[model samples]
Target: LLWSSGDESRGAEQALFQTVAPFQTQVSEIERSRRMRGKRQNLA
Candidate 1:
């Protein structure tokens, strides 16, 4: 019974991660672009 509950929680965690992963990647991509732009401005 405890084992089953643990598995259920794990599955939920994975599902949450799957949903959030894309948004996280998008945020990271935007951050990377912003950093690159800053570097370009600094170089100029």
Candidate 2:
């Protein structure tokens, strides 16, 4: 019973990670791109 509960918790953790990880990565990339564009604009 304990083992089954642990497996369920693990699955939920993995699902949460899967949902949020991509958004985190996408947000980081967007911020980086915005910074690069700002720098280029400053140079020009």
Candidate 3:
């Protein structure tokens, strides 16, 4: 009973993470590009 509930929650958590993972990568990429742009401006 309790074990099954735990498994169910774990599966939900994994599903949520799977959905979020791509957005996280996109955010990191955006941050990286912003930093690069800042550096280029500083150099100029």
TM-score of each: 0.86, 0.83, 0.94
lDDT of 3 by residue, 1-44 (tens): 99999999999999999999999999999999999999999999
Clashing pairs in 2: none
Each candidate: what lDDT?
A: 1.00, 1.00, 1.00
**Residue 11 miss distance in model 1 (angstroms):** 0.2
Looking at model 3, which ten-residue stretch has the lowest summed lDDT? 1-10
Q: Which ten residues in a row have the lowest lDDT in candidate 1?
A: 1-10
Task: Point out the higher-scoring one by TM-score: 2 or 3.
Answer: 3
Task: Flag regions of model 2 displaced more than 4 Å.
Answer: none
Q: Top model by TM-score, which number?
A: 3
Encode model 1's per-residue lDDT on 1-44: one tens digit a residue: 99999999999999999999999999999999999999999999
Clashing pairs counted in every model: 0, 0, 0
Instruction: Give Cα distance to truth, residue 27, candidate 3, Å.
Output: 0.6
